[model samples]
Target: MNIGFIGLGIMGSGMANNLLKSGFNMYVFNRTREKAKELEDNGAKFCSTPKELAEKSDLIFMMLTDVRACRAVSEDKDGFLESLSKGKVVVNFSTVHPNYSLELREMVKEKEAMFLESPVLGSKIPAQKGELVILSAGDKEAFEICTDAFEKISKKAMYLGDVPKASYVKVVNNEAFATSLTAYLEGLAFAKKIGLDPEMVFNILNSGALSNPYFEFKVKKVLNDDFETHFSFENMKKDLGYALSVADEFKCYCPTLAAVNEIFKKGLNKHAKEDMSAVYKIFDE
Candidate 1:
């Protein structure tokens, strides 16, 4: 398949490399040309802009940062909107608000191309290994056509039936995850405050019912003070904010989660660019 990928940050960079390794004809573009250079050296074609990438490929994947960036890349001057046409497929892997995903679904459909919202659940390592959980939703035919590509990028690709539904599921999923992480942080912090060895606390948690692979993996990082950009605090803040918006839209009562969202924001100024594990620094501070 003729595939194009934009947004070559940590997640996108790994995904693009996997696509190239999987033997797809990959066309890659990043706002910073340097990010695309590695892909170019690996046999992926480089494009100067999203529009140019769109012009050259049948399928385009975008993993931008947030709603604003997603919209800007697909609709701005010299963006992807100008070149989108029939028979094209645009798969969005970014974590964006459901309402924005709905808007883009229509925008691409108007251009006679199909749009799929497939927010992934994994960070740098999982993305690099193609072990992501892809929650995908869109037109059935488009979903079917994307099956091969999806297999190349994720361990599991769920067809969620429609655009905003998959987006909604993603938001809800992150709500649970952010809240869970916050709960972990609170417990760990409380342990240290009470003079319990934090390592011993983690050891107990790892051996108990509360433990899971994800929790253990993250907590081990926390114990070691290793917050080396698996997923940024600012990005977690963005997802929590969107998740809260979804809760509010549905008239759901989530005061604990609401509080957790504010807690995540506490890291924005200091640990904004670091992994979400850096939120632990907030407790220490």
Candidate 2:
């Protein structure tokens, strides 16, 4: 299948590589023209705009940052909506508002195209290894047709039955991750301040119920002070903002998430100039 991919950031670039390696023909675009050139060098075709890329491909995968960027690629002049042909499919892998995904679904149908909300659960490393878990919602036929591509780019694909639900699932997952990571960082910092060896604390943590991939992977980065951006503070801030919006819409109280949201905000403030891992620094203070 010929696929068009937009947003060639770290995660998007890794996904595009996996698609090409999976033997699918790829047409690419990114706001930064140089990003497209980098993919072109890897044997992918480049398009000057979303419309141009959409016109030449059967499927379009968008891995942008937020709802605004998603809209920019979906509805702007010469965007995906203008160039999508009947029966074409557009899968959004960005984490954004479920309501926005629903709106995009309707827009795609108006164009006689299918829209799939496919927000993912893993970050850079999982994407690089094609181990990311895909949370998808759309027409069954569209899901079936894209199964092979999903398999090539992810370790698993979940069919969530509609647009907004997938977005909800993504936000819930992220809220949990952000909250747990914050708690872990705070406890670790407290232990260190009380004269416990940070390394020994982590060793005991691994031996207890606290051990998991997220902690194992991130604790190392925290200790090493490596705040390189795989995911950014900017993106997490957007996700937290959307999660709280969902809470308000549903009249739900999520005190833990609200607290973590503030910590994430503080982390972003302290390291507004650094990476998402800078979130750990808030506790260190």
Candidate 3:
């Protein structure tokens, strides 16, 4: 299959590499051309722009960071919408608002193109091993056609039946993850504040019922105070914002999500340029 990928950040880069390793013909584009150079060395062709990438590929996978960037690339002048032909599929792998995904679905269908919202669940390490889960929704025919490529980059591709539903599921998953991470942070922080040895507290958490792999992995970064931006604080803030919007739209009373959204904002305000793991600092208060 001719696969075109845009965005070359931590997760996107790993996913694209997996596609190349799986022997797909990969065409990659990044706003920053230097980012595409690494993939070029791996036999993935590089494109100067999204329009160029769209013209040459049957499927275009977008792993951009935000709704604004996704919209710009897919809807702008001479954009993917302009260049995409009938029967092509645009697979979105970014975490975006459901409403935006719905709009994009319509946008692509207008061009006789198919839109698949396939926001992934799992970060850098999982993506590297091709163990990331893809939650997707779109036209059934398009979904079937793209399943092979999806399987190449993911441990599983779950079809959620339609566009907005998959996006809703992704937002809820992020909300739950944020909620659990916050509670985990609070427990660990309180243990330290009460005169317990920090290392022992962490060791116990890592060894006990609360010892999830996420805690095992992220606690080290939290303890070492290394907030390098694998995923930025601003990104978490955006995710929380979108999740809360979904809750509000459905008249769902999600106090925990609401609280986490506030805490995410505070973390972003304090560490606007830091990694999302810095959300722990708010719990430290």
> Least accurate stretch of 10 residues (summed lDDT) in model 3?
264-273
Q: Candidate 2, residues 165-222: lDDT per residue as tens digits?
A: 8999999988888788878888888998899988799989988999997788888888
Separately for all candidates shown, the number of backbone clashes (residues 3 or more apart, or on different chains) is 0, 0, 0
- Which one is best on lDDT? 1
Q: Judged by lDDT against the true structure, how good is candidate 3?
A: 0.86
lDDT by residue (tens digit), candidate 1, 61-132: 999899888877889987998999999999999999999989999999999999899999999999999999
- Give the Å error, residue 228, model 3: 3.0
Give per-model TM-scores: 0.98, 0.97, 0.95
| Runs of candidate 2 exceeding 4 Å displacement | none
lDDT of each prediction vs. the true structure? 0.89, 0.87, 0.86
- Per-candidate alpha-carbon RMSD to the true structure: 1.0, 1.2, 1.5
| Cα misplacement distance, residue 271 of candidate 2 (Å) | 2.3
* Positional deviation of residue 199's Cα in model 2 after best superposition, in angstroms: 1.5
